[model samples]
Target: MATFATSEQLLVIIDPAARQTDGESVRIAKDVLSAGAATKVCLPDGPEEFARALGRRGSRRPVVIGDDRALVRAVTVLHRARELAGCALSVVPVGDTALAESLGVPRGAVAAARAVLDGSERRLDLLVDDSDGVVLGGLGIPPEPVRAAAPEPVTAAAGRTWYRSLVRTLAPGRPRLPAVPSPGPSRLRVEVDGAAVVDLGQPVEAVSVAPGTGGLARVEVRPLSVGAEATPVRACGQTVTVIGADFRYRADAAVSGPVRRRTWRVAEGAWGLTLPTGS
Candidate 1:
């Protein structure tokens, strides 16, 4: 069950974004897939329909055809249904394929379709959050907020001539300030497996949690530093927790929420993905 049979029946889920991004690639993928497997093509118009389509897939293998978001959505749907471990998922990268490439799926439509027809399923680790959110790749805490630009008064003596005035009128510019330590570092309490790795007393630059080898999550906390660079506090554990002021995080390709706290635990080999043989 770890690899698809050469002619396995496939439920091909064509994401909306894929059709809008490139119809030619979609057609090519469909043609290639239909030529090989007994494929049932599904063109889901929205997220809800997509989930419904996947949920109703029965025993057929789900082959997502879209970008990273589409793949993530599929994973999330199956994970929530508590059937991800038994489901071997495949993807035909149609738009943004960076995540697929990292996961060992080919970049183009034809290559990915071919691999789907002839590839092995590899069980991969995933992170499940307290909110039942699924993270296929990784997650990070405290994405830097965009800073507001302050207007600097133009001095008469040091004033730029007509070019500067014209530029100011055309596009108000922010000062190119040198990169310096943030005036205020985020005060987050980071804990791995219930042991406080970084207490609330210490301010941190960022915190990262990702699936590591052997069913453990690799957690790293970067302390706010002045002067010399400080080494990140690192640990590997089954669970990682971050608590502090409301903050946002980048999980995989999307930004989550301004939550006061969140915890993620690793599910070892929680899901299977179809990758190129020997990948």
Candidate 2:
């Protein structure tokens, strides 16, 4: 919850995808940043250069000008490097903004840049998996469709696609869990903390794990149903474990795993992001 003074020195990294996707917004973000502070801009073509730029970011605060995917990349990169604790990150969301908006980042380039220069820093909670994957908001299963009307077919490739559709941005070379065979809905043995909430006896329709109130992770489980109304069970805890046949789950924007199981623990206030003053 540290408050940096106005016109703070900043390392503004613009993701290539952002640059290609929305040059106008990028321009607006650059102009605003250029007009506001002592800024060093890094235009990295890919993840390596992006990582290298951040690794050498000296005393300047890191400001990302991109979409949610870019923000996720920056967070994951910094978290893996163990430098997230001291970093107060900012973003000028330039593309699809669902994730950024969910995290309280304003929706447009001008306002977002203004936020970077004038807003306050917020230490936020994140979820980290055993594979060291980090989620800024949350992850869910029965991988929700990017478009609800586009019913995705169940197949091995589709399982990977399902995971990827929800997956934000993953650093290149990161190990991806095996894709599950997708001929049917997975029956996951889900547990919140140590209590079993969903068992293998029932087919699971969906599952969502998110940071909940009281610094705990919230877990929701929906059992499959044909005729009756399905009741979803909910619980809160610091950790959630899912065990069953090889299954896949969406984390942030990325889908991962066909591993027998995976566990996620809440990392309370492990990182910070800049938002408007009143937010």
Candidate 3:
């Protein structure tokens, strides 16, 4: 791992969409860091520029100024560059609440910036998809309806309020689709560490497996049913596989693939990230 000096220079990548929301606010963050005399800021206009900026991140730490998606983009770029293991990431969230709150980043851009200025870095586990892309949070099956809804530019607070209202409204109703009959499982085969765990043709709603510390894999299988509770599938192993009908899956807040099957492996302590203190 690369060691950074206490007075190391820093690069700031501000998502273009976020710049439109409040460019001045982003400027404020930049000015704050400049005044601190402990960092330097680089604002990128798009993903291409973002990648270029990160390619040159060097020993200077990176601070992302945008939403969860922005954070994901930064991590993806660093991971692709094979620098994630050594780089510490910071985020000033300007978008959706689900991901940021779950990751323990503050909502206000200024507060998040402050945290970045004073925060300690720690190693965190990241989920890697079949494509070898890293996801900073948990993955989920059956993409949530809200995810597909078109996003409108709204303040962070307003967006959170709207999302909470929508969740409350949808929580009480049965899913729009008919529930798969009991024991009416779909054909899915699962394996862990090259061992056949579940190989059957039955009704299966979703299957999730989490790689734990020390090469352990936690596996959980849920049957397709109306109002089935979503729970963690715990496992500790290096590898996991799932085969089933084509379905959409979400990694972090980004959606990917409608593949017939997919596989994931744990790359332990793959990235350094900053989370809220005491979290």
Candidate 4:
């Protein structure tokens, strides 16, 4: 880990969508970071501008102020710039909390900012797709229903606001399993490191690949559930190949493919991040 200079600057990128919904919190985060040691706050209007600002990040630490999507975007830019290997990236999560919580970032803005000021740098694995794009978290094939079921902007806001209270009240009435109409699984041929692993015509509901221990890749296949427990197929490899009919997949929340084949290779510890302790 590189030791940051005492007078090092900090660049902040706030997501545009987040700003529209909750600009005050964004402003508060900026104020707190600015008041901290040798930090400068930057508010990029959009992703393109954010990339431009980050391209010149230099020796200053970069702090992202938005949801998980925004954090992923920042990491992508830094990785492309080849700065991620040396620079520490921090995130002040806003909007959706799922990804941030999984990554161990604090929920509140003030606490997240404090984390930025007092955090250790660590090397985290980044998934690079066939296109050479980096994914911060695990990628999914045939994206989760929740992502596809996202409502309109206004409706989504209302849903999130009332989701907790509504779920609490209706928990007992809700069915344990969702009435998922079985989209019969398409045939897929999977190979790990150029060797065949799974060659079946079963219903593959979803497939995902993530980094495992010792820099090996862990591949998981979730076939259509026959019983209560969905059989999980796991494999370890350096390279993964998936060939099937046109099917879309979510790579770190962003939808990617409908192609016949996609390959993913493990780029171990390709980037570094500045995160709260025990993240």
How much lDDT does each candidate structure score?
0.84, 0.82, 0.66, 0.71
What are the root-mean-square deviations of the candidates from the true structure over C-alphas?
10.9, 8.5, 7.3, 7.1
Model 2 pairs in collision: 163-255, 166-253, 166-254, 167-253, 167-254, 168-253, 168-254
Better TM-score candidate (2, 3)? 2
Model 3, span 1-279: residue lDDT tens: 233344767877778756655455577777765665466566676789989988887777788887677788888888888888778998777645467666677766677777677666767666676787776666655544453334444357747546544543455432232322223445677777777555665456666555445534466766545576544334456777777666666676666667888888777777777765555
Please write out the lDDT profile of model 1 over residues 36-152, one tens digit for every residue: 989899999989999999999997999999988899999999999999977999999976666778878998889999999998999999999999998877877765443434444
Models sorted by lDDT, best on top = 1, 2, 4, 3
What would the TM-score be for candidate 3 when compared with the true structure?
A: 0.75
| lDDT measured at residue 217 in model 1 versus the true structure, 0 to 100 | 95
Native-to-model Cα distance after best TM-score fit, residue 129 in candidate 1, in Å:
0.3
Give the poorly placed runs of model 3, Cα more than 4 Å off: 1-6, 22-25, 147-186, 209-218, 225-234, 276-278
User: What would the TM-score be for candidate 1 when compared with the true structure?
Assistant: 0.84
108, model 3: CA deviation in Å? 1.5
Candidate 1, poorest ten consecutive residues by summed lDDT:
173-182
Residue 6 deviation, candidate 2, in Å?
Answer: 2.0
lDDT string, candidate 2, 1-279, tens digits: 567786568999998877765666788899998898989999998889999999999999999988777899999999999999999999998756678999999988899999898899998989899988898888877555453224435467646545443332332322333443333566889988888988999898788999865569988887887799788888899999999887777777677766798999999888899999879
What local lDDT does model 4 show for residue 16?
A: 74
Highest TM-score among the candidates is held by which one?
2
Ranking by TM-score: 2, 1, 4, 3
Off by over 4 Å in 4: 1-6, 147-183, 225-230
